[model samples]
Target: MKMKLELFLVVMAVVCAAGKPTSKAAAGRNKLLLISFDGFRWDYDQDVDTPNLDQMVKDGVKAKYITPPMLTMTSPSHFTTITGRWVEDHEVVHNMMFDDKTNLKLPHKLTLKKSAWWNKRVLPLWITAQNQGLKTASFHFPGGGANYSGQVVDRVLFEEFDHPDDNETEWRQNIDKVLSWFSEEDFHFVALYYGEPDNVGHAKGPDHPDRKKIIAQIDRTMGYLREAITRFNLNDSLNVILTSDHGMTTVKKRPQVDEVIINKYMDLLKLTSFEILDYGGFGILTPKTGKEQEVFDALSKVPNVTVYKKNEFPESFHLAKSERLPPIVVVADLGFNLNSRFIVYVNKGDHGYHNGEMDMKTIFRAFGPDFKKNFLSEPFDSIHIYPLMCKLLQIEPAPHNGSLSVTENMLLGPEGPAGTEKPGSGGSQGASLSVALLLCMLLFMSDVL
Candidate 1:
């Protein structure tokens, strides 16, 4: 009898061990598609009809809005999404890479391929996923093409020079290509990029009719992407995330408002050794060694522009600690543009302002079998997206600033036998407990036998 009980207990232990979800396949790792439609504002759909975007909200999960990191440019903000670190930490400080010693700023396209600018001892999502036995493809996602610590993305596509941003045909072609990558090539993840509404926004302002037209195009693109997913038979196995880097606001142009021209306040060649001005809303100046305070003082009095010493920059911005940042940083007030010397034309729409502005908030939408249906979450920071993607991939992530706790609530529980409740609702654990209790009852009954 004793020997028989020992065997039964061994069997019970084995059963319990089998019940635990230890293997990767137990939870079913789903592939991910992270798509960024550059400069799609949080409320871009509010003024326009975006049926596809509206359908996304109904079919999946949506956030109130997602906030981008400081120095909110294309490269820095996108880097934050992948690295889960602030721009001050990741150090992709701007769209244009600045060399303080040479006082030269590379244009946006050149900066995309410059390895030194992007691989700042950080592993972006592509390299991180690759390190853990997954394949990744990047379709012109900013920072996706750069080498990271001697490692490169598995597959990459760079946009041809002056590629038309509004080519709907090519956009669908890229979508088909991405679907092929997942369905035929067995790619696990992809980060696709689109330049739209941003280009229109830059030229026509956020509220212009042209902006609305581009937005309609983006809506159609969303519909096409979703339809393509179904046609490729990846609807059940893939998670799709639609998001943007930053929002666009109307630039307060001259004649309507005074422009913030720095040279008008202080002589550029005399007081500053280097200046990164004539951009939209942000400025960085490397004062001639000892002219930091003078430059700060002179620029402080300039109307519509706020200047700061590197150390004195607002801690809330999360970008002041970067080595790449110059000593003097200036930001124009909302809707204003900063000029280096003379009054010059600026984009009708611009970003890179303090993120607290409502216009600076962007959009986030996540859809997949793993996510809850028709869920609307409160606003979250974009940095948290990295950890969320890592979780969806079921891979261990390297040390990152984002917390999985912030995003896990949006996901449903792991799949088990049918009728299992979600993870947080205690269904799996409850089932395990019930099984243990039944085993105990059986043992007590066996004592009589």
Candidate 2:
């Protein structure tokens, strides 16, 4: 009994010692805030009157350009952001994905799984932080806040998909919900995903005047968010990183690649069926049987069309990295577009091809404790965000592919082991917010588990 008491005392002492801070002065030591401004452009705020985003750039490090994926679509880009694993490795190759393994589909819906088996990227930063006992939160990212690793995430804002189309009440509700998350407690790490910019940009095209208004509105909302965090005195410990899924390009003219062309080519050669999938200047062509070369040659004859096979694409593009892709790809030059038989009747801005054209430029701005105060001139991958956060939060990286730690250059403080500090001021604030969100997650996890 005496020996057991001595052992208990020793354990308590160790816990107390571990809980004590190495320096009381390092109060702003443990928080990270990541924000994603959907469809943010390289020069989005150049002419706009976006005060909050402009201030973030002035106060933090802004990337000159976050080069988008060759595919330059939404889900792939977003997957790159959170996982820090490129589509080449993370396996969310495109916006419309068909997982070859397991035959499971990830349609535009939130998924909840028993374990970390669902996501292509093994462990995201938030999950890693949660595993290390660091408090983490997410607000309406593309993939629903399903905790993959069974631990670590403290809160996830539920996305309401009941209304497919945009509603004013629902949009405002999402913003309020996100703001409430930050107001709760000292939050070590928080990620907010705002969908208006991307949603509207796609709906109205990037050139729409409404797009600018939407961008400004979201910026204002971010300002409100910043004010809330400051009002709660959580800014010093917070790092606000703002980025986008992909950039946008205006569609010029839509031209059909023609059934006549396919029929003529087939008559001259041997083939079965030819199908075309259309989106703006991008089109995916599938040839029946193995006559891809004949189909490519026929499509190349079309005015303002350049065709390439999957394997012929550049290695840097990363489009050919996955096998779940069409055989023939079409890229229409500037002021030109391609369409299927159905899309010839419908025309809209789209992004899903590798074009040498520079219109599809994405943007990134990071303001907070972990970044430098000037432009980050270095060309960094969007995937770098994954490991960068890992280093910032000091979490051991979960099993993943190609996410290298960017801590030494990114963080301002000592790069010690993760989650070593006692329950932080942010954790208390986060815990308060976590109470309500935890209940929601429990219900959510129960339904999905």
Query: Which candidate should be chosen as best, given lDDT against the real structure?
Result: 1
lDDT of 2: 0.59
Q: Pick the candidate with the highest TM-score.
A: 1
lDDT by residue (tens digit), candidate 2, 312-394: 87777766765555677777664354545433423345555452445566677776655656546454567666767766666
lDDT, model 2, position 194 = 63
Q: Taking the candidates one at a time, how many backbone clashes does each contain?
A: 1, 8
Cα RMSD of all models vs. native, in order, equals 3.4, 12.7
Candidate 1 error regions (>4 Å): 1-18, 26-28, 415-449
Superposition error at 146 for model 1 (Å): 1.1
Give the poorly placed runs of model 2, Cα more than 4 Å off: 1-29, 98-118, 145-154, 162-176, 179-187, 254-276, 334-336, 344-348, 374-379, 399-449
Please give the distance, in angstroms, between residue 395's alpha carbon in candidate 2 and its true position after superposition: 1.4
| TM-score of model number 1 | 0.90
